[model samples]
Target chain A: MEPLTLDEKIRILTESARYDVSCSSSGSSRSNRKGGIGNAAASGICHSWSADGRCVSLLKILLTNHCIYDCAYCLNRRSNDIRRVALTPDEVAELTINFYRRNYIEGLFLSTGVVRTPDYTMELLIETVRKLREEHRFNGYIHLKLVPGADPLLVERAGRLVDRVSINLELPTRESLALLAPDKSREAILLPMRQVSGLITARRDEGRRAPPFVPAGQSTQVIIGASPESDLRIMTISEQLYQRMGLKRVYYSAYVPVTGDTRLPALNSLPLLLREHRLYQADWLLRFYGFTAYELLEADAPNLDPELDPKTGWALRHRQLFPVEVNRAEYEVLLRVPGIGVRSAKRIVRSRRVQRLRLEELARLGVVMKRARYFLTADGMTSGEADLSSERLKALLLPEKKKRSGPEQLSLFPTNDSDLSALTGEL
Target chain B: MAIWRYDGSFTGFLTLCAALLSQGEEPEEIISAEPLQNDLFRTIISVASDENRGEKMLAAIASRISPDSCRLLWQAFLSEAPGVELLLWRYLSFGRTTGVKCDRFLAHPAVGPVHRLANSVGQEAHRLMGIIRFQETAGGQWYALVEPAYQVLELIAPHFAARCSDMNWLIHDRRRSLAVAWNKQEWRLTRFDAQGVPPLSADEKAWSTIWRGYFAAIAIPERANLRLQQQHLPHRFRKYLTELEKPPRR
Candidate 1:
């Protein structure tokens, strides 16, 4: 294969990388300077704090776009007509170091399709990362993709070198795997994820502080709408992954139908971006917002409300829980408030230790009072005539027209709570 | 109204804050000026900066606001944000009556400006954190240059210290004319002339070879949203970036 120009490789790998949603870079010890190695700031990476509170944002990319597998939802599927390019191990390493040098990227997010075999592809990724860390002494954020069905030793060695590792589950169930992605199976992906998670767990318990294996931790991506699964089913699988398997993130990518396979749904062209978005919101509630999957997808609300966010919808449905006292609400009660995020709730709890806060004080503590005001009572004052019935509360909260007419920001992944500009611009 | 004035610099501001604590007065008035030439006929007690008084005052005011202000206030002031000084003073005064506060200022319209400024500081720190490209140095160390809008030297250094804990690294911010260097397990901030930044590693060819290769390998072509990429990773930032190695088209 001919070597790709910088423009060509960027086109290929960035497109390939787009399907993965983990780009948070926070919580690490930061000390970016005037002119040193790396800046963990606007110059290098603008971090989006993830659900687990870990921050990551390497130059997330894949080594090649030439995939042998025909994952029906992916553009890189072998059946799809796309210009194919692959970077050599040296090319991958060189590009990462170059990106690292210019302060364009914090680290390398290197994933690749199976060029020949799982081992061959895995070996290339391992060597590329090894060369960067050992030969180039590139001590920065490196998240290597764990190819499903790669050698166990290769997977283990990858864990040792990179800051994080991800083996995407692509779809939820084996049935969906069989239907949409003929080349992929749940076993191939979950086996490696379970392996990496087990190793990460083992190293943590050693207590010797062995260079934290996957310090930023393991994450996976699941393409939404490719299979016939409900939000309940999708979240149920994600909940198990978080609790039973101990994964860092389970990215939900709205299926952008690039392939026309008879096995997949025709509606995939529009994909379920909103559904994927809602799932991410529900996922945030599950992880950091302390929501359970069953609770998020209640009996009446089987799927998320595409119009209102899951949290907002939950607040509307559970009107009986309105006007929870903010100054003295339990952490659980505080978490239930829409717009009062995990960070904001923690801030409210911590700040109360100083003084009994007023409704105005809630805003000062980072609460989006515009949304939270309808749901909470701060210092015995609520945003209502003490008599506005639950019906009126819903009307006040709903308003005849929506606040803004754009699609809701990603409420699902990392339950993204940054300025909406970060979501609409980056994604 | 006691206006405690100091030289127009962070150190000078801290120096005055330290002096204000000595009078045991909640200096309702704080101002930053570069030795304003005014011969006042009225009584103005020239507050002498006692050594211990200065350190204690500096700690008292700084400890109450945010370590982030050490990196943000100057930019906030430079932006000429209304009431930043007053808000910082207000925050300090109230923070004196505090327990785990600072996030509280996020919604305060008065302190809102400062909180917004801190958000920018965090944004800058994280942008540099992600965008900072590291070039390999001849001495087996990683080197990169940054040009943040503000003096964020103290804001983002520890990230590298923790991730690349063993290696020696430096991020030189050309805009602020400052640098953060991590060597022997410690990070130090120092001033440098931005105009005189030495050329990147006199012989820089071999260092970025592997890096350039890594950059070339990872991009997915079928999904090229250059408009979107340009929005977050703009073209103006390409000069020092290795992945964005080639000069962007005008």
Candidate 2:
């Protein structure tokens, strides 16, 4: 075979890594050293947006696409006859520095397929990152994928060198992992996570002289709609990961069929993007809105409500809590309102301190009044015409919602109520 | 009622603000003098741009009101939104009495517009920090062109300066005719005209081609949502982004 050009190698590697779906360059605030090439902003910056509407934050690519394990849902599974290419450590470092100088990327997101052994692949990843950091003196954000079943010392070293680390628990349940990825196990994945979490916690109180151990902490991704797991089960696992593993984020990647495997479910339609979006909303609720997974979901209603967001669903189910006075409601209670988000909830609490909030004033403070109008009272006034019945309110919310054929398209200038909600994702 | 006007520079704006504060009288309007803004019913007072007074005004706001409020006032001035000067004057007057607590009063008519304008400038500066792409020039310097809606060239310069301190670079604001140049150590914002740009360095095209390929390959065809893409990276920005650029005709 003719040697693959750098362009061919980059295209192949990026395509293989695209399905992983964790592109955030935030959380780590690594400032540039005296002669370094880049820095990480705490808020993160999106260099470009892809056609799929995902933000292109980093140069997300793989070291190689050659795997020993055959994960049925993975594009780089061992059984697939795809083109396999791997860049050397120097190549990776040079590419990253050039891209950083050009301001084309925040940093590099380096993930890989297992080459020969987990430890060996981890060493390759570590060497590439070390070259970028030590050899090139690059001070940019790097999110390295912790190879499952890698040696503990290798994982520790990789965690120390990078800003963020993640190991994908591609499927939620052990049974699903066994069915789809027989080579991977629940224990092999959790060991490194537990190790990194301990290291991250231990390094917190250490002196500034100690090298930061994954300053952005760890995040993981789960394949939504891949297995038969329900939203309740997924959220419950996410909650556990947050509490137990001290994870920063748990991404939900909707399964798009990459292989004609007998184990994989064939979807004739689009990937479950709406489900993924709702899960992100539910995740935000858990992290920011102070909602429990069980509170957002019940045993009978295991999956999230397709029509309404998890917050709005929770608000509708608990209608007796409605019509909370905006002027006097606690910040936490204000967060529970259907249309109010963390920002608006804080705004409501702050602005009301200066002046009594009226029904119209709530909109000026960034409240999505279309949904909040049904649930909040401002200055002892309620929407006179809006019917408070749950059924009627649900109907009112449904009219502006277009029939779901695909992912919700957000309009920049949102003229209607549903468009506004889609724009803010407040609910 | 008095309508005061000054040159559109930040120093000029601050000089106008300083004059307004000393007068202890409310102006009906504050506006830029260039392009000659006229109001038929009000008297217009033209204030000269005094640099020392502008510096004094900034220091006073930083000490008396709050450094945070001072930053907000600067950002609002950068926004160059129509009639923002009046909003800032009201905010400054309110802050003078309210002290550091002026920003906390978010719902106040005097503070809200200034705060919102500052937020708009901040948001645009942050966005431009990402979307500003640099092409390698013939002398091995990185050059980027931007036409941001707000006067945000200075706001984003510190970021690129810190990140790319080892390299010489220039970021030209096409709309405002200003450029921020960094000479591997220090950076300065200077007046510039877009006569033309230097030729591309060798390998620049090759690297860009590879980048465009990666960008195209990274997007999933199944999840193609052009509208959502447009929402985040607006059409105006797409014109300058390398990855978003249309390849030259064969």
Identify the leading candidate in terms of lDDT: 2
Model 2: lDDT equals 0.86
Instruction: Estimate every model's Cα lDDT from 0 to 1.
Output: 0.66, 0.86
Which segments of candidate 1 are over 4 A away from where they belong? A1-10, A25-44, A47-56, A81-84, A267-271, A385-392, A399-427, B24-28, B34-53, B56-123, B131-149, B154-250
- Model 2 stretches with alpha carbons more than 4 Å out: A268-271, A385-387, A403-427, B34-42
Output per-candidate TM-scores for chain A, rounded to 2 decimals: 0.85, 0.94
Worst 10 residues of 1 chain A by lDDT: A47-56
Backbone clashes in model 1: 106
List the candidates' TM-scores in order: 0.78, 0.95
Error of 1 at B133 (Å): 6.1
Alpha-carbon shift of residue B22 in model 1 (angstroms): 3.4
lDDT of 2 by residue, B1-250 (tens): 7878898888998898888778876788777754364557678899999999999999999988999988899899898898888888888888988887777778778987787788778878888888889999988988999899999988998999899999899999988899999998789999999666679999898888988999999998877888778777778998899998898777
Q: For residues B1-250, could you state the per-residue lDDT of candidate 1 as single tens digits?
A: 4556655555555566555544575655555543365546422333443466545655554576556544455555543344466666565555566423654545444455666676776666656665576665667566668777666677668766755555677788787777888894799888866553344565465445534543444433333334334445555565666545673345
